[model samples]
Target: MLSNTIGETKTARNFFGIHLSLSSDMLRFDIYKEDGEVFEDLAYRALKIAVMATKRKQIRNLPGYYKGVLRKLIDETYFKDMFMYFDVPLGDFYFPENYEPS
Candidate 1:
């Protein structure tokens, strides 16, 4: 059986603590409860940054390495303003959130 669970928890797929789902791929995302809308704006922005990094080859496919590079970029970009608000995609893994914050 092809298990599609995101993690061991029931609410693991919630994006930014909101509830929603990607119909085409079965991927879930968070929604804004106040307006019952998904967080498209921030998600879109984050995805764009990710794509740009891929184009520059600033990230590698190796495990852990890409995350390390991402953290560095986040640092350089002063993205700390929102780092805690975005969830790293599963395919790319994730950077250690505890990595010394400046």
Candidate 2:
């Protein structure tokens, strides 16, 4: 069974850091992973979801989308040899309190 307290705080911080660094335009390329075709594919999928969510003006849902993507990627049955390198809590990807899309 999954335990929320296991590395949850660290994961949330890491994901929030990533969210801060990312822009919608960054989704146009496979920038999340450095090497490996599978990794690239995973990055592409995540970016695609982000792009779609942005287009729909549902940017707030990005964290949930990413969480779903991560969950799927982490499942051994979902990929032959791919594995999650890290974990990120869905709550970490929230938009900044003062953020206003321009």
Candidate 3:
């Protein structure tokens, strides 16, 4: 799918980020995403889930803390907040798959 030209839609992916879908045989993606939108979405969902699953004490979203934490983990790896989200730290929350600590 190469036309040796710009705006060709050859791959549905560009510098700004993938913003299109593909044929059903190859794959399928129908979301317009920027660099860290996915991470932001996931982290927010994780924090929400964690806050919801908290039954002992009322968990508060302290902006000064949680915002920084979520920003720090945004682009490091996939499923980085799995432990925090699921409330099951397998002893490797700080170090997820192929993710180096900063």
lDDT winner among the candidates? 2
Candidate 3 residue-wise lDDT, 1-102, digit = tens = 222322345321331121111112112333323434565454554344444445555646333233344445442454466557786666745765788758
Q: Summarize candidate 2's per-residue lDDT along 1-102 as a digit string, tens digits.
A: 011422366645544444434422244457624334554455456646655667777556555666565446534333455435436666677798899879
Model 1 Cα lDDT, one tens digit per residue, 1-102: 001322324323333233123221222323323332223433334434544566677664322332343345434443357657767765586569786647
Give the local distance difference test score of model 1.
0.39
- Output the number of the TM-score-best candidate: 2
Off by over 4 Å in 1: 1-32, 35-38, 61-102
Prediction 3 global C-alpha lDDT: 0.39
Instruction: Please state the error at residue 90 of candidate 2 in Å.
Output: 34
- Reference-based lDDT, each prediction: 0.39, 0.50, 0.39
TM-score of each: 0.27, 0.32, 0.26
Weakest ten-residue segment in model 2 by summed lDDT = 1-10
Off by over 4 Å in 3: 1-33, 49-61, 78-102
Candidate 3's displacement at residue 21, Å, is 29
